[model samples]
Target chain A: NAGVTQTPKFRILKIGQSMTLQCTQDMNHNYMYWYRQDPGMGLKLIYYSVGAGITDKGEVPNGYNVSRSTTEDFPLRLELAAPSQTSVYFCASSTGQGYNEQFFGPGTRLTVL
Target chain B: AQSVAQPEDQVNVAEGNPLTVKCTYSVSGNPYLFWYVQYPNRGLQFLLKYITGDNLVKGSYGFEAEFNKSQTSFHLKKPSALVSDSALYFCAVYYGQNFVFGPGTRLSVLP
Candidate 1:
């Protein structure tokens, strides 16, 4: 079974452009998260949702937004892409919260110019 | 605040040699530790985790990590390194309600 699937494996956007990174999980996990990975820095959480209709800000959530309409999908939206927002984005899900092992998707590489 | 640290930016080893990737953490109360590996253009994959079991935890890809409470460290180790094992490794700690990852260390195994 495909645990987690992310769309638009790669994308290039002009400054101020908007886009959404789609994420879906077939494991029926209750927890989902969005994270960005930079060159030297580790993964930084952007947004997360514990369940459907519930979402929360992560450490670095300024340029992004997220919505969890159903347990299977949680998408992250970048309202206005900036050079600083160019990074590889990853989507992850877990069956429960609090330290549980998370399954990550292949990842979406976004470049802003 | 909870945080994780990988003191080494890179680690080099020859094939068949034992390898160690250092990791340390700081968090209040109990901590949930994890190790993940990433290839050149792929996402992070769970290697192993220490929840509340034995201090030494073994995971996929013949990788293992030891949890040392006194040292606040969870170092990943492999008995014998393989060329295919070359990749980036990350250490993470879960405290309070969130997981914080370390900067990551690159491991290169030469044949």
Candidate 2:
């Protein structure tokens, strides 16, 4: 099984451009999360989905959007990208219940100029 | 609110020497703690975790963590450090229906 996968390993976006960071998991986990990692700042939660069609904002969701149409996919959308949004984006999935360890994707490195 | 703290920004140890990476948490109730390791240019990899039952938890790469309830700490330790073990380590706590991660501590095992 692939576990968790992310598309477009690297990308460059102009300011105000729009794009989507695709994430897919073969584990069929019910909890999926999107996090952005910045130098020295650690990882910040962007958005999350408990299950298909159920999404919620996390600590840092201002410049992003997410939709979980299926249990295996949780895509993060970046509309009107800004230079400050340039960071390594990681997608993770975990089984529901309690305090389960997460499986993370390789991550998408985006540069907004 | 749930918070995680890794007091040291970086830790250096010589190969074959015992090493310790400290972590502490602050929460109202029980804390479900986890440790993740990140190599350069890669995603975070699970190292070990403390859910319940045993206070000492063993994980991958010859790593283990001890959870001290009275001290409110869960410190990661290894008997003998390896140069390949150099990486970034993160501490996290499950709280308030979500997880809160620490700033991270970089471990450098010198040869």
Candidate 3:
């Protein structure tokens, strides 16, 4: 059913470069989240949306931006990438509010040089 | 602020032996806890969660976690470890608006 689909599984960017990590869910979930995983650190929330046109900042939202223009898409943007932004990014979606089991995508590994 | 902690950085166990990965959390209101496993070069996968019911929650791949309210802990356990069980384990707590994740613990099962 392609629960969650993320494009450009891997990427490399020079400092100041910009890119977008695309995410879409077929589950028709209402909540979508963007997270980054660094070595020795668990996932850190970057941004999230409860529904189309409703987005919010998460634990670590600096250096990134997100837009939820449609129910099926939530894309994360790296306006000006930095070395510290290099990490594995993940996209997730859940059916209900707080505490719902979230379904995750395979992941996008980004390297900033 | 809501937070999650995994006291151990790494856990080692022999195949066929029992294994435990410790986790603890703190939140203002009722906490919703979760466990996730990550394989090398992959995304985190949901293992189990504690919403409102049973203290013991069983999840995929024969993994289970016991939720202790008094201790504010949700420890993941498996009886008979397999080499395939080796991976990174994360504990998370959902506050009203966000979910906070632990630093993660690496579990290695040697044959």
Best-fitting candidate, scored by DockQ: 3
Candidate 3 Cα errors over 4 Å, as ranges: none
Q: Candidate 3 lDDT, tens digit per residue, A47-94?
A: 999999999999899999999999999999999999999999999999
List the TM-score for candidate 2's chain B.
0.98
Instruction: Quote the positional error of residue B61 for candidate 1 in Å.
Output: 1.7
Tens digits of per-residue lDDT, candidate 3, B44-73, equal 899999998889999999999999988999
> Which residue pairs in candidate 3 collide?
none
lDDT of 1 by residue, A3-105 (tens): 9999999999999999999999999999999999998799999898999999999899998999998999999999999999999999999989767889999
Docking outcome class, model 3: high
* Local lDDT at A1 for model 3: 97
Model 1 TM: 0.98
Please state the error at residue B80 of candidate 2 in Å.
0.5
In terms of lDDT, the poorest run of 10 residues in model 3 chain A is A96-105
> What does each candidate score in C-alpha RMSD?
0.9, 1.1, 1.1
Best by TM-score: 1
Q: In model 1, where do residues sit more than 4 Å from their true spots?
A: none
DockQ of 1: 0.80
Candidate 2 chain A least-lDDT 10 residues: A96-105
Counting only residues 3 or more apart in sequence or on different chains, how many pairs clash (N, Cα, C under 3 Å) in candidate 2? 0
Q: Comparing 1 and 3 by TM-score, which wins?
A: 1
Give all candidates' CA lDDT scores.
0.94, 0.93, 0.93
Tens-place lDDT digits, model 2, residues A1-113: 99999998999999999999999999989999999999877788999889999999999899899999999999999999999999999999999844899999999999999
